[model samples]
Target: MSTLYTETHIGSMQLKNRFIRSATWENMATEDGHMTEKLYAIYKELAQGEVGLIITGYANIVAEEKPNAGMMGMYDDSFIEEYKQLTELVHRNGAQIAMQLAYGGTKTTYNVGERVIFAPSEVCERGTKTLGKAMTIAEIDYIVQAFAKASLRAKQSGFDGVEIHGAHSYLINQFLSPYYNQRDDQYGGSLENRLRFLVEIYTETRKLVGDDYPILVKLTACDFFEGGLTFAETRVICKKLAAIGVDAIIISGNIHGKANDMIGESFEGHTIQPQGYFHQYGDVISREVNIPVITVGGLTDIDAIETIAANTNIQYFALSRPLLSEPDLVKRWQNGDRAQALCETCSKCRTKRGNFCIVNKQRKATIAGF
Candidate 1:
């Protein structure tokens, strides 16, 4: 009988409510790949208001790939101390934090000039467009080790949990999507092989983290792009992850670059997007496994959330844009405030330069009830 405001547990971390701030890239990190004061302030604000859990923007596990396009990286040993500062800040304000670890696959980015892109396979026009050299088995093993090592670091950093980023056409997603993964040496070819990377990542991560620490995965039921991972394959992965003892699965869909295929859109849509916009996928996967299922997309309305909660099938909801515009949106909205924070979905938050503060002249300025 859980509702939006009810306290819940996903493995080790206890949440005040079911809401989580999904990972939204806000190029607010230190240039040297460490958490910055700007990033700390954002989480403190998110916690000061009403967020239950905060999943940070994608953290790079492979520094060579520049995983977050200059946002943040978790692959280094020194990052733990900076992350601890962030955890302490968020917790001091009363919010649990999780790190969403990511690795760029074919979309290897360059900070200023050109760079190399790696993937499970090298099939088509992507990355630098010159067809990346397909990764050997040895290279894939190295990636698994890297993910596991980073997870250990995240735990050491005082994070409540770590989420493997297996969605949105990143490295893990690339392996899942046949359009990019074309390897034949037992790392690609069949669906099982396609999932091997994620499975192995979870395996190695579980070995490092054990069952005490919460291990969640951010995955997509379908990539929603041409020749991308399908719902069929996604369901299989969900069940496998559940069988392997994953605490929860945060379901997301396709890359924002393909706006048309996107199930929904939001500039700050990473963490605060509503729950169950992808309920169809959650519905499919939840039916297949026992793990908690959380869905996120453009869930901007409060009334709609009430309806979602009434369903016994849903576990929780994640709201994105609303929290960005106003961190205390939950407190105000539930307290009978008709005028709510307005996030225009302007895509202002995604600019490589930095996230724009778009709440000044717009939101009608309701007093945040501390």
Candidate 2:
């Protein structure tokens, strides 16, 4: 039997398989962050396509934190009913779904126009000259409360769990990375202080969601940049998060200018560019903690996945770009296809045009012309 098709558990959430549809920025939501028919169709397709667990794109925890147009929202109770419909739709199609909660911090605010961005310290954001003002203690408290409220909203929306988007230079990441955080206060300086923000969010969210609900975190194991978060720091952070009751940890890396490196570039078919790229760091973190570790990035081959599964403690494989090109990738592999994903990693999904597979679209157009 294929290990990828076997059942697994992330806390109390039972998944039919180990293939997780990692959060991808589906520019399908409305400007107000409400779900549209387009967004619903995408989730329904993934569920029907047999994605074991579908984690929705980052949902803003507050209005000011809205990063870009068409992003999902879960900041208030008003969003609960609409998302309930989404979760119910995915469930009907036989898949578990989770909502990723995030705050853009200094890295984003383009959608909200010129506004004072929040950060751990007043410094120019990397890759851009934009200055981030240090948030006051009151503002920090508000953000922590916002995360808790968002988690509660996710549970009320019938989501299986909530994944805190602590990676990718978001609010939580800025506070965790020494490259951005420079405060000498309780929220920064020491490693424990740098981790205080995320710990607080998890602690408060757990209090609201109770013990049975699975609370996951997507973390950066290495920033891959000078003066940024190191693997050593991330290992400690992962252990702390696991100790604090985080059900699982999704390991990912690179930030800001280095973000493209994490996604990787196009390659020849079946070559599997940098296959299992982040597995080593993930393995280290996994061994340091007792919680399940989900490894993502440059994973496209079934054989490679099986090898990694057999060799490491990683319990789940998360895919983003490959799924965009082929939502039924896991199902196809399980049916004995075993071929590598057809996605060339063109990254049209990351472009402003919208999140979609240009490769598939071009192929369809070419076939239609014939």
lDDT of 2 by residue, 1-370 (tens): 5577878899999999999999998877888799887788788888987899999999999886677778999888889899999999999999999999998876764743476678898776665455677989999989999999999999999999999999978779889989889999999998899999999999999999999999999997766667888777888899888888999999986543333354453211111126766777787777788889998887889898989889888889999989888887888887878899988765766756567776676422211111
**Clashing pairs for predicted structure model 2, backbone only:** none
TM-score of each: 0.88, 0.92
Alpha carbon lDDT at 193, candidate 2: 96
Regions more than 4 Å wrong, model 2: 109-113, 255-273, 362-370
TM-score of 1: 0.88
Residue lDDT tens for model 1, 158-236 = 9999989888778888888888887776778899989889999999999998778999998976765567777778878
C-alpha positional error of residue 87 in candidate 1 after TM-score superposition, expressed in Å:
0.6
Cα deviation in Å at residue 284, candidate 1?
A: 2.4
The lDDT of model 1 is 0.74
